[model samples]
Target: MKTDILKFQNLNPEKETQISNLFKQLGGEKKQIPLKEVLEEGNHITLAYCEHNDQVVGIASMCAYHVISGKKGWIEDVVVDEQFRGQGIGRKLMEKLLEEGKKKKLTEILLFTEAHRIPAIKLYGDLGFKLKESRIYTLKMP
Candidate 1:
């Protein structure tokens, strides 16, 4: 059966729960934000999700913002269900998000992934993302 990818702005309760579970696959010990907050981050964020048989099987998100460099987008939290991996759902969701970025006329789109996530890195590279030279640092806020 074919899966459908849609923008995840307004979601019903059942599909919301399914999408929450799907997000857990990406973050092992990372606490999930409440589903309401997840979907309500801001108008700058665009989320794309794919569902199979009414169950959300994949999700990808991008945030577009204007900075000194110009309008840019940052892709984040892209994941596909284990069973659905390699079926092109992730790519389609990303394509949808990139389409959104183009519609907004973003100057550049950036994303970060651990070197250990080889398949994901490959996918990003195949989608025309380059390995950037800058080192990333994060500080946890309490």
Candidate 2:
């Protein structure tokens, strides 16, 4: 398996379709950030994934920003194709994302996983992430 951070310019219609399908596997439908924005926006955004024989099998994204404290990064949409799970594909994608974050000189990286996603939680722990003692709240705007 090969993993790399994807450049927005490298995305094509086919790749967009493939990645959209991958997000569907993770239960996200029509929720992916536009590939154009991912490419045209500031360098703080990173999109990493694993591919085998040119087919993307896993993906993760990191978005970073600077504040008074320092540069902070957030990981999102981490998912491995259901058929490709348990083979370390997700780990590879995450490692690539982390590498990108470090390259950007982020002071911290954070992520949110469903409480029921025990395996993912363990993976984050093994990767040296500690649970933050704060409540997570979300508001949906229509």
Top candidate by TM-score:
2
Shift in Å, residue 96, candidate 2: 0.8
Per-model TM-score, in order, reads 0.89, 0.93
For every model shown, the clashing-pair count is 0, 0
Stretches of candidate 1 exceeding 4 Å from the true structure? 1-9
Question: Residue by residue across 1-142, what tens digits does model 2's lDDT show?
Answer: 8998888768899888788889888774347677787767666678898888888899898989998999999998899999899999878888888888878889999999988999899899999999999999988889
State the C-alpha lDDT per candidate.
Answer: 0.82, 0.86
List model 1 lDDT by residue over 1-142, tens digit each.
3434343455677877887789889976667776566556465777788878877889888889999989999998899999999898988888888888999999999999987999888888899999999989998898
Candidate 2 stretches with Cα past 4 Å from truth are: 28-30
